[model samples]
Target: MTAGHLAVIGLGPGDEELLAPLARRMLDDATDLFGYGPYLARVRGAPGAVRHPSDNREELARARAALALAQSGRRVAVVSGGDPGVFAMASAVFEAIEAGPPAWRALPVEIVPGISAVLAAAARLGAPLGGDFCVLSLSDNLKPWPVVTRRLRLAAEAGLVIALYNPVSRARSWQLGAAFELLRQVLPPDTPVALATAAYRQDESLRLHRLRDADPGGADMRTLVIIGSAATRIIDRPDGGSWLYTRRDVPD
Candidate 1:
């Protein structure tokens, strides 16, 4: 077991204040921090900590860098936007440690969870996920398309509210449309759908539309789509905001 320790911190969406007190303290005290380029830029001022930036395809490399620094007895903070355990680098970190030196198995690792994008989007749309929900990433880069499609079908058929991440990207535009088509087979055409773009960021945009009308082509990598179940109701607030609700039947 390595004598060093590593702290994995989630920075939330884009706001610095959303960072937990513990995460802020770790970032401040750490001698080295690692994260994707965009997520790393959010850290305010930590002159003592050296930043290690990794591209999207270098998950293993990023994990190795952080583990190496931690194994060397340096306090290291690995930053991830949203919740690290949710489609983030937390798993990669663990996988790297498991595959490395035997001492790494004993390293003290702390995973501090943060607000995920789905939660942020749900809050923005007024509790769209107040009931049963499932989060799915539309990016088939890692998972096969068949597996993604099957999960979508099952989730839709089970009437579970859906939170979609990485819905659409430049190179994978058709995937969202395909998913939409699959979902429509099991869900009502008028099911409420919330498209949240760059959520919690300065350029945030939130749009509430019916599943039948939501254009998947308009979505981007930063967009999160919340598709309500059949029982979900949309109430328009007098203040021009909308609220979604799912009622549970009380046993008589």
Candidate 2:
């Protein structure tokens, strides 16, 4: 018997409208859905055999479980927030496939992309990513902190707009502070910064600040932090807020 199909999808930030049509279609067609509790909660009326909700830290375990279901000829869908390919379950699934039995490779797998947090945040904040940009996850759960630090420094030095994901969590409250300190070392004090929290959600809030004054204490897992490059600019909005963007042109 042929192996079942597996589809990995992203639900986008926190809004249903941001979800890609392809991802919604896959979710509807899936016989089994596996994801973190919060992300799985975003899916309504899936009509699947069951929704396997697990902790956020169990990516590999979740991926393997989903694959096993697919191997048993069940249409399985693994869901994540934002683009699954971006620091999400797609990598975990691929890693499992590469190390699992060769038969696992034969199963048909599709990646259904969705609006990443960076894009959603950039849109809400008026295009801070208009120029070259780099996306980094500050969580050192999978990688060493030094690696993240080095990448952050280099991205800043290269004048790339830096979009930071998972900036802070309860267990690691100091990471965002440390990250901001690092950025301050290379970037000017007045560089534009944007904090997009829960973009598009009901409680969504976007704030603009200068690098010197940006505080990390308020950021959480739901916040996406943007550190602008030299060319980034911010203009006051009519409503007393501000819009930020990076100038597309750069001199030689």
Candidate 3:
């Protein structure tokens, strides 16, 4: 009997064109698909794939269900909006595997990579993260508030450009503000900050501001915030808008 397999696939940001070809083929060949409702909706119609859509917060349940389907002699694909390994379903899937039945460990599990939001956001913003950087999720749902703040402080002190995910949501609106305040203590007020919302999507929005002037109100769950390091600088384009980038220090 052939053993079943599980594929944790990244669906890219929002644009379907950004979705990797390997991911598309995996979805086409999957017997069962699992992901948040909106992400699963992107797959027009896989011939024989059964999609199991769930709420955004129910990751563990989704992972477990996908694993179970794979164990039952089915080709399973667990989809995530951004790169699965980047604060997405990949970690949850592995966590479930570690805690699941011993037989589950022997199952063939593969992770197909996809373009992450940070990379897309940075590309749209003139490479603000071309230098050393760190990515942080501002959502305190899985971790403590203090832990997030501490990391922000340390990243800022280390002079690393920071990319923030899940910056704001309906229930959690003030955390982004607190994060900015914490960075203000370590970074200069004039530090460049880039806000990219729904990047590459129809409703995409991009904005640039100094650290002190950044408005947290503009942020949302779909937004990815990039804060420039001390070495970062903005170049004014001859047309109008500015291009922000971090200076790469090398031999003269």
Per-residue lDDT tens digits for candidate 2, residues 40-128, read 88786465458999999899999999999999999999998899999899999999999998989999999998899899999998878
Per the 3 Å backbone cut-off, how many clashing residue pairs does candidate 1 have?
A: 2
After superposition, candidate 2 runs with Cα above 4 Å error: none
**On TM-score, who's better, 1 or 3?**
3
TM-score of each: 0.94, 0.97, 0.96
Residue runs of model 1 more than 4 Å from their true location after superposition: 1-3, 249-252
> Backbone clashes in each candidate structure, one number apiece?
2, 0, 0
**Which structure among the candidates has the greatest TM-score?**
2
**Model 3 TM-score (2 dp):** 0.96
Q: Which window of ten consecutive residues has the lowest lDDT sum in model 1?
A: 243-252
Rate residue 99 of model 3 by lDDT: 97
115-231: candidate 3 lDDT, tens digit per residue = 999998888888788789999999999999999999999998888999999999878999999998888889999999989998898899999999988999898889999999978
lDDT score for candidate 2 against the true structure: 0.90
